[model samples]
Target: MTTRRTFMKGLAGGLAFCSCGMLDAASAQHHAPRRLPVMVSGKRIRTVDVHAHCLFHESLELMGDAVARILPPTKGQQEHFIVVENRLRSMDAMGIDMQVLSINPYWYGKDRDLSAKIVQINNEKLAELCASHPDRFAAFASLSLHHPDLAVQELEDAIKKKGLKGAAIGANVGGVDFANPKFHPVLAKAEELGATLFIHPYRLGELASRFKGNGWLANVVGNPLDTTIALQKLIFEGVLDKFPKLKVLSAHGGGYLPSYAPRSDHACFVSPQNCDPTIQLKKKPTEYLNQLYFDSLVFTPEALRHLVAQVGASQIMLGTDQPIPWEEHPVDHVFATESLNDSQKAAILGKNAAHLLDLKFS
Candidate 1:
């Protein structure tokens, strides 16, 4: 495995000279003297990226040396996850004030003991990162949902003791959906604790055979598809109904479901047989869409506008799947969108997330 010293040497060796302004901009955002609540448009906007990621060196070491080979390389051949310099540079360039980091745990298939250890390592690192850089970084805890009881305890500790913002979870636990009664204990605990659940895709294992292509359709289509399915299960099965106070911030613009949610409402009306008779709902499926939240990672001004039109602006927050080069200029994306007014843009950029995350700017 590459040590931090070795990686820093590589960063210096292969890197070409950049403008001092850019370097200072990256270094200054966190360290520079400034008032709190980060003003924008002559008002306190406080831009926050609800979706960002990092990798801890200790966690990687625990996974062993061969695992490091699969990690993606950043622009300067730096390890994308372990190196913080590029992340800070990108955040500075994007004008993001604070980023909420999550690990998106890869230990779902590991044995319970190993998975628990991974969760502990990830949460501890996340806490340390947030503690060290309180201005620029906050984080969600990693959970081993296969063991729901353990997950509940871990989440409680992460929020109450470690000061993590919440928990980031895959769309499903193994093949089981979030709507499963078995998972309700964890969900109840999250709702009870007022934890924000960041639902990211696990990659579609069921669609593997059909997703064969050069375009990475498995992710392009399958990632959103998994999120869509997971969300539908929550909606159609009344999981959201059971926990109306639960704060769920869906990744990838709440998958394709928000844009296509009206179809779900129509389905139950047109094809009663297809709808589960046992599962009764008080509101239309699309109505439940408003009760949820989404990220502005749709990648187009028009797409962002449509999402706002579908679910209203207050339910959306800024999310850049950073370190992946997806939606690189998320702040600019919101600004370029013509449909949203200044107030709506401000809310999506930060205020909404501040309320959900209970962030208190100092």
Candidate 2:
């Protein structure tokens, strides 16, 4: 080298040129990182659909005759079994990373023994599926709330032995409200065990009869109404107050409670005796809404926006209610909403769910 500075500068210039050339080569070979196909923000985000249903082959086999008996002989509801496979395919097509499956609560009838058998069979298959497709499926175990002791035993076996993520219970089980004292043991067990209880609505009962005519009216309108009533019963009746550790998730965006919680508080203020004395909620009815989580299956962007605002983005998890006639595209719905930023959307779509399920993204 003639001089150190001159040689160093020359070498630096050559290295810079080489680096630029490499950058150009890399740019030519690769496109800018594509955003995840569906996200609240146009960034690469993985999504988890929390409120998906998966019909086990055995469940379908058990219910096949029942399904046929219920359906119109002309149209044939037997074909509905395809809905399960179709839902799984749709999740794959939409880039949904994981689906937390639960059998719809309607199948849990008034028969305690039959319900227990059904739950055991369904959960066994669900556990098997999770084992086989460790990457794709997780599940919430269904319990036979018709028998509280049996349910508690099942909960222990499911969570401690079978390794289920959580348990799914209906808004009302065998005509007993979730807030009823009869269910206290189950709730206590769930809370003590740190289990997530996903509450869904059953199709028939006194509440369903209120809708009249076809049960579809009850399912469409009364289902969400039942959810609201059940949750309020839990809150006002002191179930939540007593068991703060219980992780209760209300389906269909927590029904109408998020929107009309003020009425409940006002009623309580007017007549404290009407509400359960055991509850010691320090805030308004709406305030406790944050304690529960909601799924993003509200159907419209406006409804979702309101729900997100009420519950905040972190408490909102993605739910599709897959394999059901009323299922919606929660991933696309979240992505299409312009109200939320990248981070908020990411939390709702998958991050929140991942945290809840204690999953690791590879």
Candidate 3:
């Protein structure tokens, strides 16, 4: 039986031939090549990016002088000014069909009320953008986890009322780790609603002072480490067991979990006393890693290949972490990866995301 990957490749080839109408000429060409084959399934596979960020002008206005106060806008920091229109242009250039717009979690500070307001404004704008350009955009609602009740209210409003596909949550909320019982109600609500939760990392303010001299070390290294820690907490604390229906999509390819699963499993087996009693997992901690979704932002082909091997292509989707310094050309990056066949590449580029987001593209 042909796998999903092979079937997609065959479909892509058929669509390409029907559209081009020069299969014989293409096959006969020896010296120079004509148009290359489309890399994904369907005639126009909606490249639904599960992870793309946008900051509206209103949000910037809300920030008011705070933006300049935090970090002066420089050449490389142009994405800081990326509004909805600017993000749309970037998506067009990158061949992304619909972007699942989210706001970076940096704006959430300790003040619960202020964070709720910020999330409200950002999520409303995101909803409006998706409504206005239904073909070009989808959205993931942002929540103020600092205020769980308000966050849950906003989530219900966004999904049931605004028709948002999912939500974007930070690894931690005002220094409170996500696995803490305080956040269980929020997780349960997400599971009940059947909404995906995209987990992004924010710079741990408490840890930033420790890396005073290293520029971006707190963001680059600290952020992924924070993700690793938060995920492990959720697993070992049995949060996953409580809400097995929760659909989580982790950024940066789930940080170090895939690489460090063996050690975690060994520790769990060898020292049950050290492991949390709440964790009643039937398999190793790493086995549950496949239950979550991941983005194709691992940077290198080898890394992407390893991720596919570990989690399989169906759980992988395209993500650019848009308007961020770490963002790469997602389409080009996947195309260059020699390890994936045409069909697997197509799935990562858009098919998986389209299915996850419940997007309808003709």
Please identify which of the two predictions, 2 or 3, would achieve the higher TM-score against the true structure. Answer: 3
TM-scores of the candidates are 0.87, 0.80, 0.83
lDDT of each: 0.80, 0.71, 0.72
Give candidate 1 misplaced runs (Cα > 4 Å): 1-40, 65-79
Ranking by lDDT: 1, 3, 2
Residue-by-residue lDDT tens digits, candidate 1, 1-362: 58545554454454332212222232234334222344556886788999887766566555553454434443322333445565666677677888999876677777788878889999998898788778788889999898888899999999999998889999988878878998898899999999999999985777799999788787789889999999999999999989999888889999999878888988888888988898898788889889898999998888899999999999999997766667656776776787888889899999999899988666
TM-score leader:
1
Model 3 clash count equals 0
lDDT of 3 by residue, 1-362 (tens): 54444433443343110111121222233212212223364454557677776665455545544544333232224454345576666676566777788776756664776666677788888878788889878889988777788778888888999989889888887778888998888898999999899988865778877866747577667878878887888777788888888999988888877666667778867887887685577666777787889887787777888898888888999887765534435676676678898888888888888888788754
Compute the lDDT of residue 9 as modeled in candidate 1. Answer: 45
The C-alpha stretches of model 2 lying farther than 4 A from their native spots are 1-43, 57-87, 106-113, 207-210, 213-215, 325-327
Model 1: lDDT of residue 197 = 93
The better-scoring model by lDDT among 2 and 3 is 3
lDDT of 2 by residue, 282-338 (tens): 667777788888888787667888898888898898886654434334565675567
Query: How do these models rank on TM-score, best leading?
Result: 1, 3, 2
Candidate 3 displacement at residue 258 in angstroms: 1.8
